[model samples]
Target: MRYLRSRVVTFCISYALWLTLSFSVDWQHLLIGLLVSLFAAFLMGDMFAEQAHKWFSPRRYLWFMIYVFVFTWECFKANLDVARRVLNPHLPINPGIVKVKTILKTESGLTFLANFITLTPGTLSVDVNREEGVLYIHWIDVKTQDVEEASRIIVSKFERILKEVLE
Candidate 1:
């Protein structure tokens, strides 16, 4: 029962990704996408297999959508900020590695957070200390050295939304 549910979830996620990326409405393209996505999902179901009850909840889905919106906005803002710094004549930057803590208990959540930091402009996740729940991020503009403040600025509501969605 659990196996079937995991495969279904994997298939849905894989197919959704395929549809978003394929950008085609033709039946031939869809048929190919369906086959490829199903094959990939069958081969990699274990990677994302989870307790179906937890993720299927409406609340979790809501939070996930909210997280997506928040992440997109932050990404856009970060890009603009980076552009401004780069175009400046003085090239003002305080390039430094700063540590930030996350309360996300699950490995998937922590990994997502790390990747989120790396994907956003002006910041790169250099390392993660899982035991200590600390992430060392290289920032183009390191505003503070304090751990709490850095976490507040870097992680912010992302952690809260992720925790709500994943846990």
Candidate 2:
């Protein structure tokens, strides 16, 4: 009963957002759109239930939004730095892979952190050790090979945000 209610609420909110973003609704069109959304929601019932719980939690959702904003700002700064390096005659490119240890316990949190690292311009997640909870990342311009430094950069910025969201 709880799952059903959550799913319905999730579907309605999603449908409303879609309708607002995609089309100018008349009475007939609104009816049709609602029907289609309900069908889709029913098809993805379990997903809606899970996602609805995650998505509706105000604290978690707020942190996630903040994470995205901070990440975007950092990416922008990193892009400019990279561009400057590329344009200069003396290209200070220190490319290398660094193995960073992960402290996040949950799989979802770890996955989010890995994806976040990859999405950022300067770093890419090369491998993940699920058993040990470690991440190997290829950095475009590595300033230091020190594992602690590298891990600090990743964990303090992104991993923390992911932990807040997922855990």
Against the true structure, candidate 2 has what lDDT? 0.79
**C-alpha lDDT score of every prediction, in listed order:** 0.85, 0.79
Question: Which portions of model 1 miss their true places by more than 4 Å?
Answer: 18-38, 119-121
| Per-residue alpha-carbon lDDT of candidate 2 for residues 1-167, written as tens digits (9 for 90 to 100) | 54686568767876997788768767887787788888877777665445455666789988989998988887787788778889999987888999888878766777788878887768889999988888899998887788888898865677777878887
TM per prediction: 0.80, 0.75
The CA lDDT at 65 in model 1 is 95
After superposition, the stretches of candidate 2 with alpha carbons farther than 4 Å from their true spots are: 1-6, 48-52
Local error of candidate 1 at 99, Å?
A: 1.3
Q: Cα RMSD to native, each candidate?
A: 2.7, 3.0
Q: Cα deviation of 18 in candidate 1 (Å)?
A: 4.3
Per lDDT, the best of the predicted structures is: 1
lDDT of 1 by residue, 1-167 (tens): 34667777888888889888988889998999899888877877766756555757899899889989988988898889888998999999989999999898778788889888876768899999889999999998889999999999888768888888887
